[model samples]
Target: MWACKNEGEDARLYQAVKACSEFAISLGINIPTGKDSLSMKQKYKDGEVIAPGTVIISAAGHCDDITAVVEPVLRKSGGAIYYINLSGDRYKLGGSSFAQILNKVGTETPDILDAGQFKTTFNTLQELIKAGKVQAGHDIGSGGLITTLLELCFADRNLGASLDLSALGDQDIIETLFAENIGIVFQADASAEAILKANGVVYHQIGTVNETAQLTVKNASGNWSFDIDHLRDVWFKTSYLLDEKQSGPVKAKERFDNYKNHVLNYSFPLNFDGKKPVIDAAKPRPKAAVLREKGSNSERELANAMYLAGFDVKDVHMTDLISGRETLEDIQFIGAVGGFSNSDVLGSAKGWAGAFLYNEKAKQALTNFFKREDTLSVGVCNGCQLFVELGLINEDHEEKPKMLHNDSAKHESIFTSLTIQENNSVMLSTLAGSTLGVWVSHGEGKFHLPYAEDQYHIVSKYAYETYPANPNGSDYNTAMISDQTGRHLVMMPHIERSLFQWHWANYPEGRKDEVSPWMEAFVNAREWIEKLAK
Candidate 1:
C-alpha cells in the first residue's frame, strides 16, 4: 500500500493505520506491530509483500490520483490494491455542511446513505474478496436500490435470490428510487463462516441465491416476486412512446377557436365587495395588471401581454388561499410566479409544496381540474420548483423532479437563449422551429433525473449563448420541460419579464430586435386562448 504525507499529514496517516489495523483484526489477521516502520518491516517478514495484495486507503488528493500510483505496484506483485478515498472526516457525514450539499443537489439528505460510511464498507468488501473470502461483488449506484438489485441479478445470471429488506432503513418507494450513496457494494460467498471471518466492515446477510431466475423481495409484512426477464424488458423500454399515440394533425385554427371558447365559457366566481360573491363573465379580457411582489415584475408583464393577446389575468398571494378564502379550481389559470418564497426554506419551493400537499381539498381540486383538462397552469423560476413539489406534472412515474444547485455554487442572474424542440405538444407547437430569449435568475435551478431506460425526455432546451450553447448544467441542457399531457409548462427562466423592449438583455448588443422571441411564444398562447373563445 502506498501512502503520502502532505500538510497535516502525520495525524491522518496515523488514523489510516489505526483503521487498517482494526479491519485486519476484524478479519482475524494477526500482525506484529510496534512503530510505523517496525510494523512495515514485520509485515514484509511475515510473507506479506509491501506493495501488492495489500489494501491502501488514503486521502492524499483525488481518489483516482492514489489509484493510479497503487494499481501498477499491485499488478507487478500479482495482486490488487483496494483504495478507499475519504473526502473529509467520516464523522461529519450528516452534518450541516453535508445537508447544504444535498440542498444544492435538490435532494433531501438521506438518513441511511452516507458517503463516508459507504467508503469504509467498500474497503472492507475489497479486503474480504482479496482474501478469497467472497465469490462476487456488486456496486450500488444510480437508480438507487432498484438498479442495484437488478445489476446484482444480472451478475449472478440464472441464479435467483430472495431479499429480506426488513433491515433497510428507508421504506419509501420514491426514496428507494433516487437515493445515491457512493462506494457501497454487495458481495456473496459460498462459505458463510469464512466470509464472516474475513469481514473488515459492517454488513448483514439479507438472503441467499436460489436456482430460479426470479428476484423475490421480502419485507416485514410479506413477499413480492418478479421475473428478471420481464423486469429487464420493462426497464429498457423507451418512455417517449408514452406520447406516441398521435392526436392526428392539429388544426391550428380549429384548436385555437376551441381554446378561445373554452376560456370564455368558463365561469369564475369572484368576491368583488370583499363580502358578497358574484359570477364574473369568462371572456377574452385584456390581461390585468399583476399585483406586485418581489420578483413578480416579469410575471406581471407576461400576464399583461397575454391580456393583450386576450386572456383574463389576476394575482393572488399563495398565503391568501391558505386562509380558506378561495380554491385553486375557482381560477381559470393559476400563475405560480417567480421569486424566493418563504425564504426558500426546507429546500427551494419546499414551503409551497408542503402547503399544497397538506391541503387535501386543494390537492383534489387540482387533480380533478387536470382530469377534466379545464385548467391551464404555468410555473416559472420558483414557480417551477412548486410544480415539481405539487406533483401536478411529471406524474408518469413516482419520480419527482429535483432542482439541483448551480455548478458555480452561486446565484447567476442573466439573460440566456433557448430553443424549443419540435414535438406533438400543444405548448411546444407555438414555438416550433424557433429560438427564444429569456432571463434566468436562480441558484437551485439545475435539473437531474435518474438514469433509467426510457424514463424521461427533454422537450426543450436553452442554447449555450444564442445558438446551441448551454449556460447551466441542466440535464440535456433543458431550459423548459413539460409533462406528457403538455398542459403544464415549467421553465427555470423568467419569460414574463422579457416581454417589454427595455427588459431585453441584448439591448446593449446593438441588436435591432425589439421584442424577444419569448414574448412571441406568449403571444401565441394568447392567440390560442382567443381561438378557444370563438
Candidate 2:
C-alpha cells in the first residue's frame, strides 16, 4: 500500500487494484484482506513532494507439502531443464530491474497476455509438481531469465547449470536474457518433456543441471560462460564474510563436495508404497468442531476436510462459545483452524489465545471440554501458536518451548519436506517414517523448545535442516509435536491444505485421483474418538 495526494494517481491505484482483483478472480483465487494508507508526503526546506502511488498485492494460498516444492536450486546433474512461456507476447525490457540497475529505462512494458494463458500454465505446473515431474522451479522475474538462472545456480553452491537460449527463437541475447516477461524455468527428468507436450503446454527444453563450476548459456551467436564462484562473489558482494573461501578454488571445491555428499544425497520417501487403505467415510463418524476466531482464515478448508473425512463438522467461532450461542458438549473432536487471528496482535495467535484465558465462561467451558476422555484436538499453524500460548502443548506452560521468530528473520512462504517420526504422535501414527511435502507460511513460527530433550512427542522433522526445508528453524527441526497424552497435536505445517490430491504440489504417480496422506490424520482422530466413545 502507498499514499498519494493527487486524485489522478489515486484513480490509477484503484485501476491497478481492480486489475489485480480481476486477475486473481480469473485464476480462481481470492484476496481475503488488505490494508491501505491514502496520504504519504514529505516536506523539505524547498517544497513538499508526494510519494509515488503504489498498490502492493500480497498473494497467498495453500499449497501441498513443502517437501515436493520446486526450489530455485539446481539439483541432480544431467536433469533436463525447461523454460515455460507464460506471456504470449513479445519480450520487452521496460521497467526491468536489470535496466534500472544499468540506469536505462525502455519505452515498452512487457505485455502481460490474457489471464487464461497464465491459468493454463499454472494448472499444468501444478500437475507437474503433483506428479513429481519438476525437480526445481522458478518464476521468470527480477533480472529476467538470466538472474533467475543465477539464483538457481547459487541456490545450491555445489551445483551449476548449462543452457542454450536458441530454443527461444531469433531473439537477441539481451532481449532473450533480460526481457522482463511472465514465464517460468524448471528442472526435471527427460520424461517431463512428453508430459508437457501431451498436455499442450507451451515450453522449451533449454538445458541441463551440471557439475561444472559455471553458468553456461549458448545462443545462435555463440557460447557464454560465467565462473560460479566469481558470480557469487559479485552478486552477494559479501561472500568474504558469508563463505570466506569463495575466493579460493580448492577450498570452494572441497566445500562443494562435502555439501553434495552429505546434503544432496539425503532422501526419504512416502512410507505406504501405494498400499494404505482408503479412508472409509461410510463408517460411523464422530461429531467435530472447527474453531475459528475473528481473523481465522483457514476454517472453511479445514471444516471441508473434516466433513469429507466423515466427521459431522460445525463451524464454531470464539464468540459463539463465550456468548452461550454454541457449545462443545456434543463435539467429540475439535480442529483448531489456523489463521492470523486479531491480525496477530501481541504476537502470533496471542490475541486469540487471550480470549480463552480472560473469559471466565469460555475458560470454564474449554476446561470441562478438555477433560472428556473421548475427545481429541488438533491445532495447526496459528492454532499451534495459540496452543503453546495456552499451555495446551506444554501442560506446565514452561517459559521455554515457546513459538518465536524464525531464524531466517523474515516471513517465509514455501513448500517444505518433513520426515514423520517412527514413534510419532497419535495423529500421524500411521505415517511413521514417511516423507511429506507441506506448505508453511509464517513469521514467528520457530518452535523454541530449549528443553525438548524427550518431553514432547515429535511427529515430523525436516528432511534437511536447512533454510526452507526447516523453514522456521524449530528445535531439533521439529515440524509437529504433541502433548504428553497424545490426544492433542499441534503442527506448524498446513496438512489440511493437501487433503485433496490435486492440492498437492506433487503426489505419487497414478495417485492423482486419491486423497493426500494428510487425510489420515483426520481419520485417525475420528477413529480414536469412536473407540473412546465406545
Candidate 3:
C-alpha cells in the first residue's frame, strides 16, 4: 500500500509515481493499492507552509519460516560480523541522516545501483536465516554502518564488537563510517560462510564479538572505542524524556531505571516436552464457548486455541446470552476474550458488566454456569475486568477484586514475561514454575485487591515487578487470578494470542515446535473436563 501526502504539485507527484512505477516494472512487481492526500499546504497571513511531498510504501509478504528468523542483537557467543554492501561501493552522504544532522544535503545521493544484485543479496540473507546460519542481522540504514554496529550491541545484554573498516580502503574515513550505503551486516557461523561463498555474494568479515559491552573501531584515520552502555543510555534518555510526557514522570523514571535490570529470564516446566500428547479420538471433544462483547476482537483466537486443545469451540456473543438465544447450558468451558468491550468508554468493563446485571437472562445464565460444579471458565483483559466487576471469583466476599487504570496512566500494550506460580487452577496448574512471554493490551488492567494475598488464588505473576514489564501495576505483580475452587480464572494478558511459538516476541532458541508452552493451559482444561465427564 502507498500513502502519499503532497502539496498541490501535480508534476512532482507524477514524477514520483513514474519513478516508482519504473522501479516496480524493472522488479516485475505490482503495487495494486494506494491512497493520496494532495492537500498539504497551510496558508498563513505571515507566511505559507507547504509540506514536503512524501509517498510511504507499505508491503506485506510471507516469510519462509518465522522460527528461523534472527534478531538484530549481538549474541554473547557471536562469531564474526560481516558486511555486504549493496550500494556497489558508492558511499553517498547526500540526503542521508549524517547530512541531516550536519544541516547540509550534499549533491549526490545513495541509490540502488543494481536491482538484480540487491535481489540476490536479499534472497541470500533470507536463505541464511532459514538455514539457521545467521545469529544476528541488521541493515545499514538511517545512521549508516557505525550506527548499525552499535545498535546490535544496544539490543543485547553486555554485548559489543570490534570492527576494522580499514579493509574498505576508502580515502575518506568519514565517508566509510557515515555514508548512507545500502548494505547488510550480520553475525554468522562457519556453516554460513560456506553457503555465503557458494552464493558468490561479495561479503567482508569486518568484526568479532566481545564480552565487554563496548564498541571498538579501526579505520584509516585511527582507532576509536566507545562505551556501549553509555551510548545506549544516551539514546534511551530521549525515550525517557518522551515517555515522561505520556506515562507521567514517576512511571517513566521507574521504567527507565528498571528496563535493563529486569531482563527476560524464562524457566520452563520440567515435564514440558513441547510436543502434544496424543488424545483418544473415541471420546467426543468437550464443548467450549468463546464469549465476546460488542467491541471484543480476540474471540476467534480464543476459539481457535480451544479447538487446537481438543475442544469443540462455539462463538458466544453477549447479544446471544442477553436476548436468551443461547444459554450457558451445554458449554462446559467458557473463554472470555480480550478487547475493548463496548469501546471501554464506560470505563473498563462497566458498560459490559451492566448489560449482564441489568438483563435477567444473561445474568442468570452466567450465574448458573459459575454455580455448576463441572464447568470451567477463563477471562482475559476486558473480560477479566467484567468478571471482577461482577464479583464472580469472590462473590462471597463483601470487598471483591477491582480492576483499575494501569499505573502508566495509559493502555499498556506489551509482550512481557510471566512466571506461573504454584496454583490449583484447573487450566494452568500443570504449567506451574514456568516463565513464558504473553501479550498484554489493556488500559484498566491493574487488580486492586482489598483482601490478603493468600485469599485469592494467584496463578501467575509478572517476571519483572517493575513498570512496563509488569505492564499494569496489579497488586503483588499479579498477572493471573483464579477462584478458591480453581475452576474460574482471569488474567490481564492474552495467552490465546501466544498459542504458537511464532506468536512470541522472543522464544527460547532450539524449540522448534509450532505450538508454544501456553497451549498446555488449554490442553489441561480439556483434560480436566474429559476426566470430569468420565
TM-score for each of the candidates? 0.43, 0.65, 0.93
Q: How many clashes (backbone atoms < 3 Å, residues ≥3 apart in a chain or on different chains) does model 2 have?
A: 13
Question: Clashing pairs in model 3?
Answer: none
lDDT for each residue of candidate 1 in 1-534, tens digit (9 for 90 to 100): 332333334565667677667655654454554333322222345574332122333333323221111110011112111212122122122223333447643423333333445455555555555554444444444454546566555432354666676655446533432444433334444353344346444454666656677878766656778787666545533322331232212322222222212210111112111121121357435342232233343565656655644566776654444555545554545557777777786777887777667776555555665675644566788888888777666786677778887654556676656666764444455566555556788878877765452455455676542211343467767777777766567878787876644565432222233354455455445554446556
Better of 2 and 3 by TM-score: 3
The CA lDDT of each predicted structure is: 0.52, 0.76, 0.86
What are the runs in model 1 whose C-alpha is more than 4 Å off? 1-283, 286-299, 451-457, 465-469, 507-514, 530-534
Best by lDDT: 3
lDDT of 3 by residue, 1-534 (tens): 122354337767788899888777776678998877767777799997777677788887787666777788887775789998987757879878889998997988887777777777778888888777889988988888888888998866778898898788755777877887889889998778777788778888998999899899988789889899888888799989999999989999998888776677788778777786565789799999988988998888899888889998889998999999989899999988888888989899898999999999999999999989999999988889989899998887899889999989988788889999999999899889999988989999999999899888899999988887998899989999999899999999999899888888777766777688888899999989888877
Q: Model 2, range 116-231, lDDT digits (tens) per residue?
A: 87887788888878888787888988889898888888745556887988979877888888888989998887887777787678888898888777989998888899887667
lDDT of 2 at 512: 32
Off by over 4 Å in 2: 1-100, 105-176, 179-214, 219-221, 227-282, 396-401, 405-410, 448-452, 464-469, 500-513
Model 2, residue 137: what's the lDDT?
A: 80
lDDT value, candidate 1, whole model: 0.52
